[model samples]
Target: MSNKPTCRWWPLAMLGAILAVVVLTWFFDGLKPELRLDMRSLPPGAGHWLGTDTLGRDVWLSILAGSQRSILVSIGAALIGGSIGVGFGSVAAFFGNDRLRFTLRAYLAALLLLVVFVYSIAVLWPTVSSTGHVSVGISILLALIAFVAIFWLLLRRFNLLRSRITFPLDTITQRFIEVISVIPRLYLIVAFAMIIPINMFTLIVLFAVTSWDVMARMVRAEMLKVREMTYIESARIIGLSESKVFFRHALPNAIGPVATQVCFTISGLLIAEATLSFIGVGVSPETVSWGSIIHGYLENLQAWWLAVFPGICIYLTVISLHALGNDLDRMCHSKH
Candidate 1:
């Protein structure tokens, strides 16, 4: 009755386009690296809509393949990272005693520091060696195991020190978060890429590990507020187990902000992956990605289609995710 027109189909259309791209790439997997030396670097024409790359591979097909990989990395990282953050944060906020909280905080801090140190060593190890006999990738893997062993020993030392001193867990956690927040995230990711393997699975895991802190902080802040609500107190008064009250009541209410954070996080991760690929640190040389496509033809002035087409896809995907996140945030706030 009002003058407003419904555009409910728009979101569906966007989703359908994304799914179509993914599905088509899978269906046409044979075209992934098919070379056409006869048509190398040709501009857009009837035979090749988006033209061919320097290697004579179809630009359009490459974009489609890249999208599938990027989407998989983003979605995989978001789901696993979000779950880990939510679980750890909700439990920390609602269930732990002072000693338990201290131990958790200490462990998280140690793990973060250990990862940074090991990654640094792995990145620089190759340069330090006089002989080129050692493989950087193998060094990183061995360093990972060594670092874990070192962390175990350090954890034991910290546990002993923890018993001798008592500190506010909240204050310690806040300080640690602030310290991490001050460091540039992109540089940190690059550092990890330099040391860690640059395959899709490892990239997904790296993103998840780096990203969980933000999710944890958001969930913890939300849980802190939700825990004081009357419903939570009532659940406790009714003799519900602490885990039951926390998981069933506190977590559900606190999850709204976390969901919004997750949406934005996915977009950021996508961009991060692309940026790393652009700089040659994201995926392996053999793997195709939007960033890799752009990087591939960057030196050729005539291969404009290679850059422009994939660049547009990257822009559209990131914008779509941001719009979705904004809508979710509004819906969540409206409910509250």
Candidate 2:
């Protein structure tokens, strides 16, 4: 009895309680985040529990309303990203050396080229559409031609080396991870936000894409270690298919850490969403989120509740999630 508050039970109970309140609030028929000009900046009292915003929106109700979508987005992104990351990373670790050996002339190179071209097009669209300059258009056309020329030159060079040597997929994957991990994920999401419309689905897509790398890297490391384990060889010798061995044996052994990683992923995505919403590009204009509530208070510090309550909500959710994740991570390591 060191008096340390290390129990894992609290987070689960706390998260459940919060979610219950949020869900019930969402379904409550009478409560809505309506604007009232006359009721501006009222303190917590008779009717409103958490006070009012500059727009006269009920702070408590707004937080509940925002939680509806915010929680949904975080959960959705976690499930999708975790699934893809763990699945691919496990498989990639096992079969990487075999399946990844290809020539520079492989269609894989062509596919990379296509990806680059599509990204370039996306980047140039706003500029071309907003300012519509002939010189700019001509310059873009020339750049595209240069890209094509460079692509052809690389293809030819790669083709020449196809017979002499094959491409190392392990190297390619590692390089990709390094490159992606180095770039700030928020910047990528912001880039996409500029090009595409922001909505729940869009946010989910963005989070899924940005959030998977950590899980993938973690799973890949675990699977690689598990790959060398004695039982994995036995499974293979018994004629189990790669997929079956992976899911039935390797994945189960390796998933505890990755599973815990999901908690952190959810926490991270929640923060990311809030950051984006604060910047005014997160959800659609009509939709409200925790970040949007805080954003509303930037100009009007007098309405302190606008920032404080939602900040409390976000702090509780994020910290509870992190604490749970930390406990889970410790449990996972202890078992090993």
Candidate 3:
């Protein structure tokens, strides 16, 4: 028999420390991130612990405020996206017939292509309408409406396909996953942002939509493996319903990978949020976020503190999340 591997502690320690900082920052909400003309662009000193931005806002206060927003958005995106991925993936793997699986795979592929096309159109909308014949806003609105309509149609079709199961697996799903895997996610985000009016909620939605495919694929892979186990077969043999066999016997065992996927998703979403903000397309200008804070100082190279403090916060938070995910993944493997 193999000896159980001992769990590492530093990941948990780092995660705890990061959470503590975030919580502490939240409690100091009284220190509002308002402007102070007298202290504008001041270096770190007795008056401002982290210095002041060009707009005279306390850097420390901004960092705290930004951290709160970033964390909330990241957590929200991760939870929503992870839930979606797990649900869709588990259903496809366990309940899907071959025809249903093929339809779903086709839908996913079409969805990817739709995203790319929409993003491209959004990016070129302004240039294409240089003659002022078409309003950019109207173009964006139409594009968004089209995206929604297509998505709804695909969903309706998926439901219809689900009603008629033909086979257990489809190679098309794997091909769809591979196609999506090769696309540049950052470019996709930037393109989407160009067409959409970005706010915190919109950013969260964007992250959730784009990031869910990976989580779904992960869950699907795990469920496929688990469903083939002897116990699952025995449960089926004993006349357990497919739903029961899936939810009760297979799903619970497959959760470890899902949990790890969620952790990593949170980190990736946070980084995506930051990148959007850095590029001036994430949150609204009025919203306080670490990415926005860093972006504000881009014009003034000497305002190093403005960028450094928030950059550090983003770095630490993402690293902590990644470390925690690694630990969770290791624990999951050890159990197997």
Error of 3 at 302 (Å): 0.9
Please tell me which predicted candidate would have the highest TM-score against the true structure: 2
lDDT per residue (tens digit) for residues 1-336 in model 1: 763333344544665697688877888767576767787788899978999887777888888888888888888899888987787677667653353434554565566666766665555443433234457755766676677667667767766434342435555555655665677767876775555445677678777866777887888888889988999999989999877887789888888877668768888988888888888886666678888888867768778887899889888787777777777677677666
Candidate 2, residues 58-104, lDDT tens digits: the string is 88888878887778889899999998888767767866666444554
Error of 1 at 307 (Å): 1.7
Candidate 3 error regions (>4 Å) = 1-10, 13-29, 99-183
Candidate 3: deviation at residue 228, Å?
1.3
Clashes of 3: 1
CA shift of 153, model 1, Å: 17
List the candidate 2 regions with Cα displacement exceeding 4 Å. 1-7, 99-167
Pitting candidate 1 against candidate 2, the one with the higher lDDT is 2
Q: Rate the local accuracy (lDDT) of all candidates.
A: 0.74, 0.78, 0.74
Looking at model 1, which ten-residue stretch has the lowest summed lDDT?
Answer: 3-12
In order of TM-score, best first, we have 2, 1, 3
Alpha-carbon shift of residue 8 in model 2 (angstroms): 2.3
TM-score of each: 0.75, 0.78, 0.74
